[model samples]
Target: MSTAWAGGTDAILERMEQMTSLFVEETRKSMYKGESATHCEECGEEIPESRRLAIPCKYCVDCQTALEKGSK
Candidate 1:
């Protein structure tokens, strides 16, 4: 009934929505944990004191930053 997606924009938007949902879920999971020194659960890197003080359980600021960039 429509031809809007003939250019691939629909596919791109669908993928973006999926990725956004996944990002939101993971972020909620991390932020809802306890108030302990956040350590990168994936890489064992020590999250900075500033980050923990602000977020409560960030764990590995660098790794998280990299992951966020990769997602973009």
Candidate 2:
């Protein structure tokens, strides 16, 4: 490949890597750092283990979505 084409490709690859890193960092930060709640604070629904592990959430997906929607 020509030097110019190689340089452009390198720049693009670098930018992509940076973006991926940023996205991962943001995702990690977004996850709750505190202990996961066993049940939904708003509703009496039991929070699933999978959801708790994925994110230490206080509410189930449905309730969380509703709360968010209502907040808007």
Candidate 3:
């Protein structure tokens, strides 16, 4: 009984839900594990507490930015 437009909308919504679930799962997998590092792995500078909590990874802001830029 659903119209074509309604069916299309339902399909779009279902795809969006699937995409959201996949994104969440991948994010969880990529998230840093173990205790957060206090110093930048590259420069040995003390990582700010805010940055540590925000990223919980090895690199400090400067190093991380440089690494990202280099990858591009």
Candidate 4:
């Protein structure tokens, strides 16, 4: 009975380790600002009025739109 409990504990510990590793990987990803899409991230584009509101960003409107569509 003790051995069975130990085995289950080991499995749980292993899964926890995997989850922790995955979390670290994701954290690393978010560390970066954004992806490349030719357009500025902040204003959406050099032309759009929305760009003035966004500020300090990169990707443009068309690129963001394509990204959203691709993800789906």
Best by lDDT: 2
TM-score, per-candidate, Cα-based: 0.42, 0.52, 0.53, 0.40
**How many clashing residue pairs appear in each of the predictions shown?**
2, 0, 0, 8
- TM-score quality measure for candidate 3: 0.53
Q: Report the candidate with higher TM-score, 2 versus 3.
A: 3
Displacement of the residue 1 alpha carbon in candidate 2, Å: 52
What lDDT does model 4 reach? 0.61
Each prediction's RMSD over C-alphas, in Å, is 6.4, 5.5, 4.8, 6.6
The per-residue C-alpha lDDT of model 2 at residue 32 equals 61
Alpha-carbon deviation at 9 in model 1, angstroms: 20
Tens digit of lDDT per residue, candidate 3, span 1-72? 757676599789999999999998888667666767999888999999998887677878888899879962
Q: Lowest-scoring 10 consecutive residues by lDDT in candidate 4?
A: 35-44
Top candidate (TM-score): 3
Q: After superposition, how far is residue 55 of candidate 1 from its true place, in Å?
A: 0.9
Residue lDDT tens for model 4, 1-72: 567676589789999999999998887667534644345554446535465355433456665567658852
On residues 1-72, what C-alpha lDDT tens digit does candidate 2 reach at each position?
Answer: 567776588789999999999998988667665798999988879999999998889898999899779962
Expressed as tens digits, the lDDT of each residue in 29-69 for candidate 1 is: 77757785657776888877887777766547666777768
Worst 10 residues of 1 by lDDT: 55-64
Deviation of model 2 at 34, angstroms: 0.9
Local distance difference test scores for all models: 0.75, 0.86, 0.83, 0.61
